[model samples]
Target chain A: MNVTIIGTGNVGQYLIRFFSKIENINLQICGRNSNVLHQFAVECECATVDSIKKIDTNADFTLLAVSDNAYKEVIEQMPNVKGIVIHTAGSVPLAVFGAKFNRCGVMYPLQTFSATRKSDFKNIPFCVEASDTDTLNKIHKLSKKLSKDVRFMNSEQRKVIHLAAVFACNFTNHMYSVAAKILESQHIPFAVFQALITETAKKACEMNPVLAQTGPAMRNDQSTIKSHLEILESNADLQKLYSFVSESIANFKKQEDIND
Target chain B: MNVTIIGTGNVGQYLIRFFSKIENINLQICGRNSNVLHQFAVECECATVDSIKKIDTNADFTLLAVSDNAYKEVIEQMPNVKGIVIHTAGSVPLAVFGAKFNRCGVMYPLQTFSATRKSDFKNIPFCVEASDTDTLNKIHKLSKKLSKDVRFMNSEQRKVIHLAAVFACNFTNHMYSVAAKILESQHIPFAVFQALITETAKKACEMNPVLAQTGPAMRNDQSTIKSHLEILESNADLQKLYSFVSESIANFKKQEDIND
Candidate 1:
């Protein structure tokens, strides 16, 4: 299978790394800069082009791994191709490809990526959606080569998944950032909390997170909650977050109790 | 060196398990029920007492691992001795041990514990505080036996650490619970998100979490944010939480930009 990837961003480069490793797949990359694209091509040991218009249309799949905001512009610029066009965005819908492309789909990898960090896609779930079953099957089969888990989800379901990820990945990370700030204020290194944070994530994943919940909020310990709030008094934003989240936890527990 | 544990809850039992493994420590455990204490003593391979009053005061340290609510009553009922008194709670002050005990300190391990979970103390940070240097050194030495990382933090500092942990561990776990709930509503198993959640935590811990932040809020992608809020509209509590956290993330990014 000949796969062409547009947008030499983190996600595109990430796919290139894995797709290149697969023996049967011939991959080419597209970037906005020729000199940088040439250098990246040498580094990745793959073919590269400077523009999406210059990309080979004979490819099995042309993955637009660009930012969601650039989706329409990139699609409009790409050459008309016989192969399926896919996007690697979490939020963008398949119909964004428009009537210009006959075969279009989405193959959103549900994981965060960075240039310096090593990401193993073996266990990562790839959410695949297509306009047709044939396109879906092809993408699912290709996704399986990179990961063990691949699920077919429409644009609506994928949108929910992406939203859930903001809570699971983004907001959860913000909590760590907040905690690090608190520890930093005390002249303590955030490293000390690493083990506990790691274990907390581990336990939540291993069990039903609702059942795995703990702390003053779960216990409804007014004294501890009061002390925590007082500690946050100087930072109104965090103080507000602490109160809102604590009350939500209490309310969740109350609802559970009533249901029981 | 004799150490008597005056509670058999998860934290107490956790200490008992590790303490019994150390060769120099002679550990005795106490419980409210005689039969339970006897069985626990047999399992831990240590001495047991049904009452804190009957606890061997000749011990070098008496650890009151009771909950914060039970601290006052537990201390009031205990008979005095020369051995330093210690409590293993985060928010509770060293003064809570009070004027009754001449030598007192705290040995609060900063981690969540459950009865069934296997907690490794090797890397868990133990936050220790004391009224006197002598008691501090003794508790610090004992704490080192269980964990490689032990720090001397006074009551005020310890309170802040506990408050920080509420965000790092408790509030973070709540975010996972909310995410799980969102996925469950879509009939998608929460297991699919395990890899992303794990990596989110790993990245935050390995790097500055503020720098590690990603997604719509960090990008200030209002369209994505609007869609997420729309999806969450049915659940007023979650919608409120989503909006609040998203705004906080944006505010946090703005603060970071100013600092830079």
Candidate 2:
């Protein structure tokens, strides 16, 4: 099967590298930047193009792995393909394809990607959606080749998952950033929290995150809360965040007791 | 060296199991709950005492792993120990030791523990503090046996680290709980985002958490943000948290650009 992956950003590059490794697959990679695309092509040993128009329509799977904003421009001028087309976005709906293409779907790989590190997609969950059984089955058969966990989700469900990804991955990452800054100010090495962060994620996955909760806020330890707030007093945003999250934890704990 | 552990909570239990495995160390376990104490004693093969008063002063180290509120009450009547005294609380200050003991220190292990799983202390960060070098060195030497990352932190710095733990561990887990709830409401399996959560945490630790930040909030994609808010419109607390964190991320991104 011929698979064309568009864009050269993290997700696009990741798809290119991942699909290149699979058996019985022909890969074509395209991006707006020729220099980077050329570099990536040599690095991943795949075909590269400057425009989607250059992509042969004979490809079995065309995956648009571009940025959310660029999706419109790319899709607007995107030539209709005889093959199944898909976008690898968490938030972007499959409807963006509209009637422009007979067979289009979403095959979003539900994981964060970065060019710096190699992503192992074998165990990653792929949230796949399409307009019909034929397109979805094609996406499913293709998705199963890459990931062990593949699910069919509607647009709203995918968006919900995306929002949750924001809270779980993106926002939680920001929380880590806040913590790093707090330690950085005191000259504490970021290494101190590495094991804690890993273990916290592990515990959350093992059980319900609500049950895995710990620390001062969950315990309603006012003195600790006061101490933390005092330390964060200078930063208005952090101070606000710390207070709001603590209150939420306390509230959750209370509800937990009532439920018990 | 003889060690006495006061309490049977998760931290205390973890310490009991961990320290029991070390060579050339004697363990004494105490707690108010006899049944739990008996269970732990049988489980860990240590002497169990119902009162802190029953613990002898001959121990080389005595660790109070009780809750924060109970620390004062337990310590007020805690027999003066010839051993180094320490508490495992993240927020509680070492000053609580006062003149009550000559070698009082803090040995706050910077991780969340649960009774369900065995905690590996080999990589966990142990934040140590003491009134003098002799005590500090003794604690540090002892800490090195269990963990490679032994840190000499003052009461204030330890508290700061503990506060950051709240954000990085407790708050991050809460975010996962929110994500799970969101997925549950939409009839989607929580497993869909497990890889994303794990990858996000891994990325956060590999580099600066600020640089690892992603998602709609980081992008300042107002459209995506608005859609998320609409979905969370009913939960006032969640809505508030969503906006507060998104705004914080956007503001941080702005500051990052300025720094660049």
Candidate 3:
């Protein structure tokens, strides 16, 4: 299959690297930035295009890996093609491609992408969505080649998935930042918490997260929570966060009790 | 050196397993549960005690790995003679041991403990706190045998360290739980978001978390945030949490911008 990827950012770069390794897939990398396009092309030994207008219509798949803001503009600029057009977005809808394209779908990889970090796509889940049965099958086949975990999901489903990702990945990491900042204020090294952080994450993965939950909030050790809040009192932001999250956890625990 | 582990919970089990592997240490495992004591003693080939009164003070090191509520009772029950008495707690103070014994300190392994899940202690940080220099050196040497990452910290420092850990690990995992719950409500498999969660965590570890922060909250995409809130509105607790955390991230981002 011939695959043309638009946008040479982290996502595009990673997809290029991943797809380049697939023996049967012929890859073409594209981005508005000529420098990045040339750079990725040189690195991957794949064809590079500066604009979507130059995308090959004969290609089997055209993947719009661009930013959410640039989706409509990029899709509008792409050459009139009969090949399947897919956007690798978690939040965007498939209908954005319009009825003009031969096929439209989403191949959203549920993972953070970065140029330097190599991801094991085989373990990562790819949420696939298509407007038609044939297009869906094609994307599903491609998804299976990359990962063992794949699911057929529509725009609405993808949106919920994206929201969940924000809570699990994005917000979780933000909490880490909050912790780091607190430690930084006290001149304590963040490395002190690395082991604890990693192990906590592994536990959540191993069991139901609710069961894995711990700390003062979960235990309802008001004394300890109060002491912690006192320590964080100087930082109003953290204080607010502490109260909010602690209350939420407490409420969840209470709900669990009632259910039981 | 003789080591008495005064709790047969997760930490106690790990310590027994760890110390049992080392040739020089004499292990004494104690717990209130007779069956648990018998099981650990038979499996680990160590001495077991059902009562705290059975604790031998002649040991080179006494590790109190009990729950917070049971710590004081266990400590009070220990025999008079002592070498080094240490507690594996994050919040408990070193001074709590007082000058009642010859040597007292802390050997807090900064990680979530679970019997089923085996952790590689080689890299996990052991925060060693001692009342005096000689005791500190002894604990540090013992820590070095198990882990490469060992640091001398005071009770005050450990308190802050625990607080930071709550945010980084415990709170972060809760965020993941919230994410999983959201996805579950939508009839989506939580496994689909694993890739994004893993990558996001890996990225935060690679760089400063604050710099790596992204999402509608960080971007101040109020429309997206509003939509997400609407999805979570039925769950009032979660909705409130979402709003508060989003607002906190926005404010933090603003502060970061100002600092820059």
Candidate 4:
């Protein structure tokens, strides 16, 4: 399989490394920055190109790992290819290719990536969607080389999952940031909450998160809730967020109870 | 050290187990429910008392592990104790002990406890506060037996930390619950998000969560945000929460940028 990955960003770099490991795979890295592309090419021992138009038309797959906002410009710069083209974005739809490309798909990896840490794709779910069955199967085969958990999802499902990922990964990180700020004000090291945070995430993953929920809000302890709101009075934004989320939790519990 | 636990709830049971393991510690279980107290006493091999009045005055510490709302009623029923009397609640201030007890303290274990899982105290932080140094030290020694991360916190500091904990632990868990609901609505398995949730938490603990933030909100990707809001239109509560939290993230970024 000849796979060409465009964009030299985090996702692009990740795919370069992953694709380079598979047997009988000819991996290529594409980017406008020649220096970084050269550096990554040397690091991954893959071919590097400065333009997507220079990519071989015969390549089995061309994966555009660029930012969503740049998709249109990048797609316009691409040369018509006979092989499948896919974008590695969660929220982007396959139709983003429009009539510009005949064979197109999406291979959105559902995981958080950080430059400081190495990501293992063994358990990461790759959400694959293609314009046709054959293209889908080809993308699935390619995704299987990187991860075992790959699913065929439509654009709507993928979009919803992306939104869910925002809550699970991004919003959750914001909660941590808020906690860090609150602790900083009290001269308390954020380290104290590390164990609790890790444990809470583990529990949520292993069990039904709604059922595993705990804390004052879950108990609907008006006294503790009031106390927490008072503590956040200095920061109106946090206070608003704290009160709103608490109410959501209480209402969610009620909704669940009614469902049961 | 003689320790009497005055409740049969989760926190009380955890203390009963921890205290039972220490050498030279005489353990006693005191609760209004005789049947539950008797069973716990048998299981823990400790003395059982149907009333706090029957508790020995010479007991080194009496740990009240009841809910915050029950603190007043429970403390009202307490017999005068020469040893330290402490409650294991986070938001409750030390002043709640009042003038009835000469030696009153607090040992708030900052962690989420669920009946389905076993909790390890090796890394859990114990926030200790007291009326005097003597009581504080006594409680610190007991806390050290269970966890290495013990700190002397004032009532105000402890209250702030408790509020921070609600964000880090409770609010974070609520994020997972929301994500789970979103996935459920789309017929997507929640299992797909496990790796992302776990990785997000580990990164937040190891680095500054604000710096570690990613996703459409962090990027201010208006297109992705708009699409998500459209998908969430059916649920007004989640839609409001989604918009509010995203705005908070953007504002938090702006605030941090100013600080820098």
| lDDT: worst 10-residue window of model 2 chain A | A40-49
Residue-level lDDT of model 3, residues A1-260, one tens digit each, is 89998888878888888888899888988777888877777777889877677878889888888777678888777788778888998888888888768788899988876666777889888889998898899999988888888888889988888888888977887898898898898798776776676677677777778878888898788878888899988888788889888888888788789999
Expressed as tens digits, the lDDT of each residue in A1-260 for candidate 2 is 88898888889878888888898787888789888888877877888788888997889989998887678889988887899889999888888887898889999888888778897999898989998898999899999988888888888888898888989998899999999989988899888999999999999988889898888888788877888899988998999999998888888788789989
Q: Which stretches of candidate 3 lie over 4 Å from their true place?
A: A24-26, A76-79
Using TM-score as the yardstick, the better of models 2 and 4 is: 2
Docking class of 1: high
Candidate 2 is graded, for docking, as high
The CA-based lDDT of model 4 is what? 0.89
TM-score of chain A of each: 0.95, 0.96, 0.95, 0.95
Candidate 4 local lDDT, A1-260, one digit each (tens):
78888898778877888888889988888888888888877887888888787987788899999987889889998998888999999988888899987889999999988666787898999999998898899889888989999999999899899999999999999999999999999888888888999999999988999998888989989989988888788889999999999999999999999999
Candidate 1 lDDT over A1-260, as tens digits, reads 89998987778778888888899777899998677578767776888888777899899988889987789888888889989899999999888988988888999999988766888999999999998899888899889999998988889889889999999999999999999999899998899898889999999888888888889899989988988888888999999999999998888888879988
User: DockQ for each of the predicted structures, in order?
Assistant: 0.82, 0.84, 0.67, 0.85
- For B1-260, candidate 1 gives per-residue lDDT tens digits of 89899898778889888888889888899988676677777887899888777999798989989887789999999998789899999999988877998899999998988877878899999999888888899889989999999998888888888888989888898898889889888998899898998999899889999898898999898888998999998999999999999999999999999999
> Which has the higher lDDT value, candidate number 2 or candidate number 4?
4
By the TM-score metric, which is better: model 3 or model 4?
A: 4
**Residue A95: error of model 4 in Å?**
1.7
Ranking the candidates on TM-score from highest down gives 2, 1, 4, 3
Native A-B contact fraction in model 2:
0.85
Model 3 gets an lDDT of 0.83
- Give candidate 4 regions above 4 Å deviation: B32-39
Docking class of 4: high
